[model samples]
Target: MGSDYSKDNCVHKPPMDERNLQGLKDYLINYNLPDGHEGYINILLYGMVAAGKTSIINTFFSALDPDGRTVTCVPTGMDPNSLTLELKTYKLAKLKFWDTAGWNAMLKSHVKPKELLRMILEGRIPIGTNLQNFKPTFPEEYPVIPGNAIHGVAFIFDMTTMDNISGNIMLRFQELQTIAAQICGHRVVIGTKFEKLGINEKNHAWIYEYKPLQQKFEQLSASTGLNKQCMFVVSNQWNGEHITMIKRILALYALENMIRNIDRSLKMTA
Candidate 1:
């Protein structure tokens, strides 16, 4: 086996092809915290407006249960100024997800977004603590529990529109990583709309070899100040009642990687 046993020439189907999809999906369904205390693996997701966080999340449900319909973990098409309330928590398979309100740019936090993110990791901000209604009287202080607090953080970006991300936002994401490493040592960079690359949509296995996706990964890794290894991309077939099997596996693979990254915070190597 010479470095993945495929050498560097394997393109059409590399190590991360359909072979690992079902395994990854099964792993998540059966996954549990290594500590064995049974706690939700809280992971925080952040990004700009229309970054495809909700779409990517819903797609995960479709991946997990291909025979079933997708679930709205976080409300999509949000109107922050409107009276609609956010879900208290997007809990599934003991993985709890938290996302910011869709009204304003995450960079537009009442305080710097990193500070707010810090508040989340430390477990100070409770569920439903929307930035639009921030008040000193609310959100009683608390400590980061193994199951309750945000143990990992992931930044979402639109794969189709990554070129348009501003330098300032990139810098902000970099700054946030400082807090992530210190708090939980878990951080993921996700690119949504992977199918938008110039490659054929059905050729999902060629993702790593495809020139356009490879370039986008390089660009995002460089811009976000994260390692290319920490980056993952997925196609968003969120609206489809029935997704192709390859796409389902790809989505589950992305979800599994994100969870495994969170597990690092809980001291799991794999």
Candidate 2:
């Protein structure tokens, strides 16, 4: 769900001047909307710590690897509180999700996140290393792909928290959007912890009503123009009901937008 990475497209392509190069660099670095693949939607999960980012991953792809043993060593036990010291990729249906520990994780490590991000933008890291043992510490040292391949970024938030009332959430969201715009030109916000939202007979034990939260989200969407892109009330533990709904929505999102680009690129121009 991104630009074609064919060696020919990278090589032999005309070089850009500094401005154009910077523009391309911005496009390569930010969060992207899925736009050009049929069989795959490359997504990165990002959110504040303790927001249940990994939990969603566990819930969706648990069938593939039951114990979720792979991410156990990342940093925190059952969670990576700070850094994504390790990179793990999972494939489901036609989409691939690259679960990135929130950018905050870079704080504890000696490594600079910006440098690591820059390397990803430039596409210097080797692709397809064994994720089971690969440890990412420094920018030059981490095993990552050369050039940016990420097509989408999923920003997960805890819907149960009233943090939306604080101005900080808006500020942070704007900053993240700006960064994503600079890097990949687009980003998607995902509201998680919906299990705590209005519950149901199948999975009905929620603590709070999410009507207020939905109102806040509506405001957020209007401000960001991400109304259609937003995913609300996601509960990973549901009886495959809400989860299935979200999956279908995400699949349609990727298929309609990202896959369309791939088809266009592959089409024979008359």
Candidate 3:
């Protein structure tokens, strides 16, 4: 089911500024590594199944490619079983995007929140490790103390299935919030598939233009203690004449949130 809003009432805006886009590109390219840290800034992406996390990463890379090449470095699919069965990391210059298996509420028995937090926070989970029936690995198992702690976490949600935001989902999200609070990293929510809600593709103002949609997320943020500004809605599957601009806009918002989280993390560590 979709929202009750109609297309006539929707708002629209001009395309994103070229200057701002360039600034974000430069920021990601020239991000400073913290003292004694040689690796890229680790940004963890997590969400339920079919939330389009992988597509978001691909879209980001496509936007950054000057040759306009479509980059699908990470594998992505719609399998109900987690497509990303491992802790995969994609590096773009100074930024490292880590994509984990989709969190299944049905598998809560095997994937407890605390254990998942440990795997993410300490980077203890081994690559290609399936989360189904998964056992938590202790920190001592590592030869050296894993220091690739995430500087930011992005929770991608399927906006088309907002009605399916069950109690189980909210509970898990709350657990993530608790972990982020403890680790001093920032959390942002990205709502994908705006087209499913009948949102016009050319309407650039859809991010915060629709009051009802904004209110729904605002209430969720209030309950989950997520920063209201961290929520963004975009169409990851938009394909048409203006596909490039749409993807670029989506990438801009995604990177903007990532940068905000990174800055927040640095301040907390300082």
Candidate 4:
């Protein structure tokens, strides 16, 4: 096992265009949403608190938005409790990004997690409503509208928590993916807080060669029941302040996978 990790990288070619972050950003910015019954594509970010879903959104805008500045377009932090208290939507680069309250496995059944998630997935839950376990938050007149439904999902897992996440939590994550796959048809697992894994700017270009990431993939596979092929690692803006060039490029690489997967799902259904 040591030799395998120490040997050549599993990924021969990295997906990132280090020199062309701007160009990549430009291409995605101009990219059109594939024709669908829905007026726009809605991608939901789901994970535990501190999973970095919000940061991922900030990462996308930081790297892709024309402003060329790092800003907290979305609030994020390291607290285990969710910073996002509501189901909210942010307009970005031709898609609707939904940032919902992080999963809390401890909810003792005021509203079951899967049941609430189903409500969210079907667009039955009202945006801007506080995500809660105290009661149902569905809209009284929310008819099944394609425009309001989720188009894709990013199942984010904090690299720091994958190995030790409780069995119950892992089960919830898997269930979330199962529900998401039923709706989106394709999936991407994002392992955030990846910067802690010994990858640095000098070597991030050759991320595929990093042995730790491969091991991390195994951990994710065990936890999420998703394979490495569909998983992408990202380290969002550190301390919610400086967004390094390396972080920007890596986040872009993950976004590219997500956009491509969304496009593929669209084609398969077409």
Model 3 per-residue lDDT tens digits across residues 165-216 = 7786678677777877677467778778776665565554444566566665
Best model per TM-score: 4
lDDT of 2 by residue, 1-270 (tens): 112112321211222234433333233223233444234445666665566666666544432222222222223324325334355566655556666545545534444444444444334444443333434665556545523355556667677774543575556455655555566423566666555555443322111222444454666565455643344433444443233333323223322343344334334221
**What TM-score, to 2 decimals, does candidate 3 have?**
0.82
Candidate 1 lands at a TM-score of 0.81
What is the descending TM-score order? 4, 3, 1, 2
CA shift of 186, model 4, Å: 2.1
Q: Candidate 4 — which residues are off by over 4 angstroms? A: 1-12, 15-19, 36-38, 78-82, 137-142, 239-242, 268-270
Candidate 1 C-alpha lDDT tens digits along 1-270:
112123243322424545576677679888888774467777776676787766666677767774746555545555554232232456678777676654235444455666666777777766676665554343344444445566676778888887886676667767877777788657787778776665565556556666666677778777767877777776665445666667777667667777876676567543
What is the Cα-based TM-score of model 2? 0.54
Better structure of 1 and 3 per lDDT: 3
TM-score pick, better of 1 and 4: 4
| Cα error, candidate 4, residue 240 (Å) | 9.9
* Model 1 alpha-carbon drift over 4 Å, by segment: 1-19, 66-68, 77-88, 102-109, 136-146, 268-270
What is the per-residue lDDT of model 4 for residues 1-270, given as tens digits with 9 covering 90 to 100?
Answer: 223244353633544555667756766777676675445668888887777888888777777656456766776665454378788898876778888877774256467777667777888877787766437554345556546688777888778777787887777778877877676655778888766776665666666567878888877777667777788777674644456666677777777767777777776776
- In order, what lDDT does every prediction score? 0.65, 0.45, 0.67, 0.71
**TM-score for all models, in order of appearance:** 0.81, 0.54, 0.82, 0.85
Off by over 4 Å in 2: 1-40, 62-84, 108-148, 162-173, 201-210, 222-225, 239-270
